[model samples]
Target: MTGWLDRAAENAHKFAQRNPRAVAAGVMFSLAGFAATAFGVASPSAPGTEIAQQIISEDVQPLPVHEQLEALAAHQLELNRSTAGRANDTADRLLSRLGVNDASAASFLRRERGVRDLLDGRVPRLFTARADESGRLKELVVRMPAERRDQITTHFTRVTLHPAGHGGWKVRREQAQLESQVRLGSGTVRNSLFTATDEAGLPDTIATQLSEMFSEEVDFHREIKKGDTFSVAYETLTADGEPITWNEGAGHLLAAEYINRGRVYQGMWVRDAMGRGAYVGMDGQPKQRSFLASPMEFSRVTSGFAMRMHPILQTMRAHQGVDYGAPVGTPVRTVGSGVVDFAGWRNGFGNVVEIQHDGDRSTLYAHLSRIDVRKGEHVEQGTRIGAVGATGWATGPHLHFEFRIRGVHQDPLQVAKATQTPMASVSRAELQQLATSARTQIAAARSMGAVRAE
Candidate 1:
């Protein structure tokens, strides 16, 4: 038997050597079959414990069809739409555009005095309306400029009309605190500052602030070159995150850079621990001089301190003050901090205000429609002392501003450049940090503007 087994093994080895590929394939197939039987398949369970089973039956009632339908209706779809209130936007018309078909909502809007005023102005207003999927009005809200002119910068008017809990619609009108949103913008002047700002999609208020921020170093009206550029980091006032259209949503100018006639000027707003803040330059000098450059925030220079044809006299005469053409109700501010020396009318300068400042200097604002200060009252720089009007011996509504030294008339434009020391309390580290951030922000704004231009 041993001899026979050895002969068979010798014969198998010879065959394997001749067909090595066939032998390897056969070995792999046998290993895979063994693995599949051992691990890949589950073992069967023993059938020793068999238990008896029983079946039971019952009937269950479902909810009523109406109740199921009511549950679905409770989650009715709500729709929202927004539109601007035009001068010709009636209650029905506005509601129609907002996808509302309810006549009761329109009637309620027409009946309420506060709500009706939303469509009274020619200036378009942003309106948001909520309704059901069936076009029934749910609520209407509109954010508008403040009613009082003085609060335009800090306040906004919010009007809401909705269904009252009792049943009929109720209108709510209130003055809301305007929240400030930080904004960055940049523009290059091709024609004018206003034009550039418009093209750059910047607010008009920012343009005015930029002009005022660099007024001491550059004359925006006369010295502005074609290629002048500006960058600004500022704030825009919003009510409930919605920007108010009127008054340009004006807020504080935080930082600014102006390139006027090839000279680069930069300013950053800085504050101390006392909450007092001011615009300062890169060298930490206050941009505010001894006085502000203009009484109004922004306006066209209709007349300068030169010999010009008098509108009333029809003869060429020396225009002692600058005339800023603006609407009648435009705010007129004090150019410097001072005590009111005169707050009554003069012969030609009707309803005038004269402030006596330090350093033997004084300033006068003429042709004011209303004066907010008395003769003995002390006023600060940039205080609204009055509003512009055509009450004087003049042709139209404008501000006649004059700067005087020792009772002699001087150029109003020159007063803003007068040397004044900066505040001493601001920390050096705080200002440096603020300047670094402002520098980066201005650069970013410029780059963004360039990208948009391209």
Candidate 2:
């Protein structure tokens, strides 16, 4: 029997040498068949039977680990692409539903072009897939980066009807709870606020809110200067303590704190003394100043307040007020609280609004595209009275703002000052304690690497 086995092995080697490729294939097939049989093919009665029969049996075909992982990644990428496109579409629909005009939506989407860069990698993106009981995709979230999450939340800014004490439902503004942040390093300008805030981990909407907060004083397109720094703190909405993302529900802005060029500015969402919803300073005052430091945020004063030849008129004029060479409809605001004594078209002044304030103070706004406040109506400091226009004796769209004391014209730039709100005696004492606690809390938060939502 030993001699016969040796002879069979020698014959097999000779056959393999004659047909090397065929032998190798046959051996591989036999090994595979043996494995299938060992793992329990459909029919244990046949060990090395037909490959098709073995496959049809209970033998499971196991994929390699690496191939399985590759397949999973591909599947996830496909899902991400599909979800992202759907999210974009959903955003457009939501914007339309919220009454955002097509032009505005286009502009907004244009500004959000950075989203493409953010979705570069096959990163796992989480989005709230809102659906009915049927499990359909009702909404898809274009997940915002951690830095911009606060500003990109899915919140609605709506005007609702409130029950008036006398009769009909009066239109009132209401919003969902939302949070935003803005961070501007030193030596930055106002125009770049959005970009800077985005880097510092704020959302675009929050940056817009920040700009609006200081619109009366800072012109994003003009007024910001190098060496100017800013930071913001604000609130965002959450569910069960988890901040909601854009794919979730909406939120409201609870409060905000801003600091610019060493000056601290703050705002709180509150019901005013008249029960109207508004944002006010820490002292319950509006977040505004009498006048902006410069009409142009970054432009040098080409001309000062003095007697000079008018550029277009080419005649020597007193130039009573400062000329802010801004675009048409640039808002012109009141420097202080007052009543509009005059809002009409005047010779050499075009559309004008003359305000008379307490202490014999008065102000005049001329060359306006339109007047907002009516005559005899009271207005607060920084209230928008008109929009800049090139009317009457002007060469371009610019605000011709003037300040007066007892009817005597004064330099608007030098005359306007910020009125400070004095703390009450009791409140002052409480403030000291509050400040102490605040300092401690701030330190703790900093140590823990946590940012505050002011």
Candidate 3:
């Protein structure tokens, strides 16, 4: 067998060498045939049988649409900017401070009769002025108190000074409408009344109104503890057909309630037969007393009304009034409606004000930097009387407030509480109408998140 295999191999090798090209061609053809058979078994369609073709479409243009431009005036798009300033004593000084460069407008306003009356007032009038691009005073407006010879309408004056095309201004005086809207808000005191009200989106002016409304009843500074809550419905002015900003032209507190430390204090605003508004309770009793508990809006009782060692004199003495430690220039207000019996420097009190209220009642404010009222001047309740200071016999800036009756000094806080009058419920017929109206308004307000602007 071995001899036969060897003879066969030798013969094959010899044959391969003689026909190498034919041998290589035969091997390639065998591999190609095997691959083709394997691929052909899995093929879905036979190649070169018939290739399918699809039709191609040409593009077309879109349809046209017509349009036109709207016309707008250049001046209409431009806004007239203004700056507000308080008028000084003289017209020249006020014009200088207000940056009014127009000599013609200045001369016209100075010569105008209405302008002079509007400018001259006990308190400096607030004026708003506007100038054109060339720095010429184009308009000047001052909101003055309306002078009504006969009518009892709630109105004000909008005195406008503008160009008349005759090289001077035409002074126009128009009746300004003092429109008002009722607004509502409720808040819980977490840190402070101001903080909570601010968080509730209430204005500071309204917050001040709330404090004043409940001033005689609530001790907002001390008695107002955590978890105390309050709700208020008040009027906000819409002045001269313009929207009232948060700080400008704040109206009065219409109604309010303060729930403090297991006690509830309520106030409602109502107009009497004479159309005079007063804050009362739901039962129709006056919420306001003869005097407010405190004269300073925001203060701390650093030194109570008692015997204490005088800081400056270094001696034991009776501190007849409460000493509220505050920064200088804090506003001091009158506790009640009264006349300014005295507003000047005293022996120990710096800029002192003595207001004599009804029924021989009086209140004293001392240690003031500046006095705002003069002697014999009638001031309303909560009117600013002076600014806090360290005037007179004091070591630092504070308000020494005292409540006196018939020339006898008493504890201000105690006097405030004692002055509260017993509230009497209104008649059933009258109560039904007022309560229904109030409830309806409050419910409407509660359902809304904010006051709707007109």
Best by lDDT: 1
Candidate 1 TM-score to native: 0.55
- Tens digits of per-residue lDDT, candidate 2, 1-454, equal 1232233345455545754554544321111000011111111122232332323221222223224446756865422222322323444444343333344323333454533332333432333333333332333333332332223343333222223343322333334433321111111334466554554445444455556556555555554554455433333443212244443223223334444565655553332122123344555545544444443333333455667898878999877777777778777777677789999999999998998865446778778888899999999767888787888877777777777654656665544322222222223333333334233322222221122111
Question: How high a TM-score does candidate 2 get?
Answer: 0.29
Off by over 4 Å in 2: 1-302, 417-454
Go through the candidates in order and give the C-alpha RMSD of each one to the true structure: 29.4, 29.1, 36.5
List, residue by residue over 1-454, the lDDT tens digit for candidate 3. 1232233345445434754543443311111000010000001122221110000000000011000001222342232433333434556666666666677776766787756765564532456676765557777777644555122135666778878787966778777655544455665688888787776556666676577667678867677899887766665554443334423344555567778996987766554333334556666667656566678888898887666798888999877788888999999999899899999999789889999876446899998999999999999999999999999988889999987755767677655554444223323444444545455434333323222110
Q: Could you tell me the lDDT of residue 85 within candidate 3? A: 33
Q: 260-292, model 1: which lDDT tens digit per residue?
A: 877889997654433344668977778756577
Q: Give the candidate order by descending TM-score.
A: 1, 3, 2
Error of 3 at 400 (Å): 17
| Cα lDDT listed for each candidate | 0.67, 0.45, 0.59
Minimal lDDT window, size 10, model 3? 33-42
N/CA/C clash count, model 2: 13
